[model samples]
Target: MAIHELAVNAVKYGALSSPEGHVTVVWHVEDRDGAQCLRIEWTETGIPVIAHAPRRSGFGTELLTQTVPYQLRGTSTLTFKPGGLQCIIELPAKGVLQ
Candidate 1:
């Protein structure tokens, strides 16, 4: 659902909106605070111009900022850079696979 929302936004208003824009997704297991965790990075680049963060919180924003922490006990950060939007999500591996 999270990725879906990002894709939808990209298609409607983000990097995917332009022919030259692109999105890269990468995931791996990494050690954080002495614990193993899954880290996912979503990056958008090649955009001619990047929009500023929305003034209001939408469903997708809420999902990333609120629901993810409550349900997954993880963290999500969205950064708006000159290139495009970047999202990083981290989920603790301890109970994730169970």
Candidate 2:
């Protein structure tokens, strides 16, 4: 769901907004304390800078801070770069099938 939201945003306002725009989504796993951790990244380029963070209160912000984490059992961080947005999500790998 978070991926979908990010994709939609990219299409509506981020990397996909212009001819030079682009978006990248990647993920990997790391071992920590004998447990696996899944890390996902979403990056956007070619978007204009509007705000340092998401709006104070909105559906997007709500999802970023609450819904996504609840559903994935993970935590997320957002960074706005000169080009666009970057998001990182980290999740525990326990009980998850490969």
Query: What TM-score does model 1 achieve against the real structure?
Result: 0.87
TM-score for each candidate, following the candidate numbering: 0.87, 0.84
The top-ranked prediction according to TM-score is 1
Clashing pairs in model 2, backbone N/Cα/C closer than 3 A: none
Residue 74, model 1: lDDT of 92
The candidate maximizing lDDT is 1
Q: Which ten residues in a row have the lowest lDDT in candidate 2?
A: 49-58
Candidate 1 residue-wise lDDT, 34-55, digit = tens: 9999988999886666657677
Q: How accurate is candidate 1 locally (lDDT)?
A: 0.87
Name the 10 consecutive residues with the lowest summed lDDT in model 1. 46-55
lDDT of the candidates, in the order given: 0.87, 0.78
Residue 80 miss distance in model 2 (angstroms): 1.1
